[model samples]
Target: MNLHGWIIYNGNLPGNKFLDFAQWIQAAATRKNSTTTIYKNNELLSYLGIGQLEVLRQDKNKLPDYVVFADKDIYLAKQLEYLGVPVFNSAEAIDISDDKIATYQRLAVKNLPIPRTIIAPKIFVSGQLDKTTVQLAMESLGFPMIIKESFGSFGEQVYLIYTEEELYKMVESLQGKAFMFQEFISSSYGNDLRLQVVGDEVVAAMKRSASDDFRANVTAGGTMTAYKPTQQEEKLAIAATQAIGADFAGIDLLFGPNNSPIVCEINSNAHIRNMFDCTNINVADYIIGYILNRLN
Candidate 1:
């Protein structure tokens, strides 16, 4: 039971899946005489059998030297922190970065330029809905604004409201969840930069083209092409990662009306698979190595 490293990857393994990553790490550690353990939530439950209280009673305190939580389960990472397990990016960082509003707030406080934004109440369901409120928000923030759910990913819960009617409809539709409305930054190039940063280093970068549709996420049918960040843009990305204490992040920057760079969002568990072929850097390996070195 001498485990070398532990991987907290999501999904089941060894059943239409593989432990090759853990195996590779184990091999890396074997030179120092150790093995690796792959801990998926499914596999953990299967091995532990019944309940959490029962499992906790067993006192399996001999955890691996380093544990990398690959998934975006913020709560699980925080729980591991209580167990003194070194986690990548820290649970708090993940929690903060998960919220678009909170992440933007943190960046703004750090003097980072973000799109002029404001959060709007999601409730306007009844009679005499506050038209004045919506009107003021649009006027103060300006029109052609973008509304977003505080915790959505991949352009899923984001919308653009160019008119008061669209804004009202969006507010009525998302009546229970918190939303943010931000001034739309017009990048004449019709693209935004997705900068992948690790430990103050801008490792991989890409240019995402929004098909006249406006949402810059690929899920919204936006195209992603290889991009190289200018030194200033790289500085902005690094500063943003540091602002949120994120060990790994995807800092989304868009060009404003004068080519001014404005941060639109930050993703904690940024998917690197899309950027792999475009950059010379192996982001996954770099992330794995960075976490192992820092947390170990």
Candidate 2:
């Protein structure tokens, strides 16, 4: 029997990147002799009324065997899963990966080597941060630390603080937002590794570097190159993915003082275009193949 799949992406998001990801997966599925349909998260409405839980689209009766969730719409993803549809990188994994603090907590519990991190206190009202909490964070992480919002992508909400003043200003600007303070990994200031892990294997890897910025995010002006990660790096990347219960993930690794691998972050729906451009490897192929094997 031929498998049928649904690739869901966020329609509200600007730009074609999200749609592009869905297309890639659809193409891969087609190559594997499976049929796939692409849908926007908004296109599928989740209705919750009393004892009814229904996800409705144009054809409510036409449900796929599995879903390739390429968006961070946790509710929609969860709804599909509740309907007995297998969602790649399950809703639970997407939830953990979507929140930086939650991801860190999960990794920490698993004893993964993540950078030293301290969750910012939740502030009900917006204003200056508590002096005592600020002092404690500074004392623990020191200057030139990293401040990153809990829910962000493309490295847009990440800030590098060089002094107390900078930290205070950044925190003030981010008041009423969930974020964390992390120790700066000087050894990997402008460079990091992106290892694409699918099912227990590292499918593609790349090194991203930015000379003028502390962030190595390719979307933040960083350049990418094909890379060969060490066994330790590969193992850590895979472990980090599994820590969040992700079937596949793009795991970013920072270099420690002694060149050891440190988990920076994991992207459950990591964009594969950059990796393809760098390594000429289509991660979609691996993703589709993994899903096929699991289903079979």
Candidate 3:
């Protein structure tokens, strides 16, 4: 059986951490008696002769059983799908999971409680930002709201707005970008859960808190501590991951008023950090194993 894992990225490998993960996968696959491939070209297919690349133009007689696209680009994922290789989580699923608005809408429709959200157009028309419309949305869901660009990762584009003035400033600053505005949930415990899901199962989970900052992402200097998941939180994490049809994911969950658990966001291509120390699960190995399982 032949299985190929593709590391598609836009630039130089971000850090040694990525390379470390790749090395771990390499070792794991070797032990399993499987072949693994890494394609590191970041330039566009046309610029770099993607037609000549084995992934783009597969050898009809030697097609790979599974292909994993690790890049943040959706276009490349779609191109691979067109070539008939069964990609993990497929291009369509990646496209949906990457967008914040779509992620919330899909989860909410499934009866999964998500914070109240509103999507504003990329370029606001003359009447698009009527005061009454904004007021009504804010009335039911009050201050200290969150606003985020449609596609961002590692807590880079998330914003916390506390007052009307700040909201206007944010809207004006982000006038020409796709954004999602939502009410913020103040966790009574002052921490949020990070659940890593692999193919419909919650493999590793942790609680992260930025005691000094509002964002709970470790990249933003948050402290990641071991968290024990309640039976309900574990089930919710699995359901949310499956709802988006993600084979491997990082689901952000929060506890709102009355201790109601809510899903904040679903992540594609999640980086595993502090996960191994807390859970000792070898999340990267599990992710690679899932891909191999589908191929077998």
lDDT of 2 by residue, 1-296 (tens): 79999999999989999999999999999999999989999989988989988887887657899999999999999998988999998999999999999999999999989899999999876866798988999999998899999999987888889999988888888889999999999999999999999999999999999999988999999999999999999999999999999999999999998999999989999999999999999999999999999999
TM-score of each: 0.82, 0.98, 0.87
Full ranking by TM-score: 2, 3, 1
At residue 227, give the lDDT of candidate 2: 98
Model 3: CA > 4 A from native: 12-17, 41-63, 122-128, 188-190
Worst 10 residues of 3 by lDDT: 53-62
Off by over 4 Å in 2: 125-128
What is the C-alpha lDDT profile of model 3 across 22-106, one tens digit per residue? 5565666667666766555354352235454333333333455556666656766766666677776677678778888888888
Q: Best TM-score goes to which candidate?
A: 2
Q: How close is candidate 2 to the true structure, as a TM-score?
A: 0.98
How does residue 34 of candidate 1 score in lDDT?
49
RMSD of each: 4.8, 1.1, 3.5
Better of 1 and 3 by lDDT: 3
**Which window of 10 residues has the lowest lDDT sum in candidate 2?**
53-62
Q: How far is candidate 1 from the true structure (C-alpha RMSD, Å)?
A: 4.8
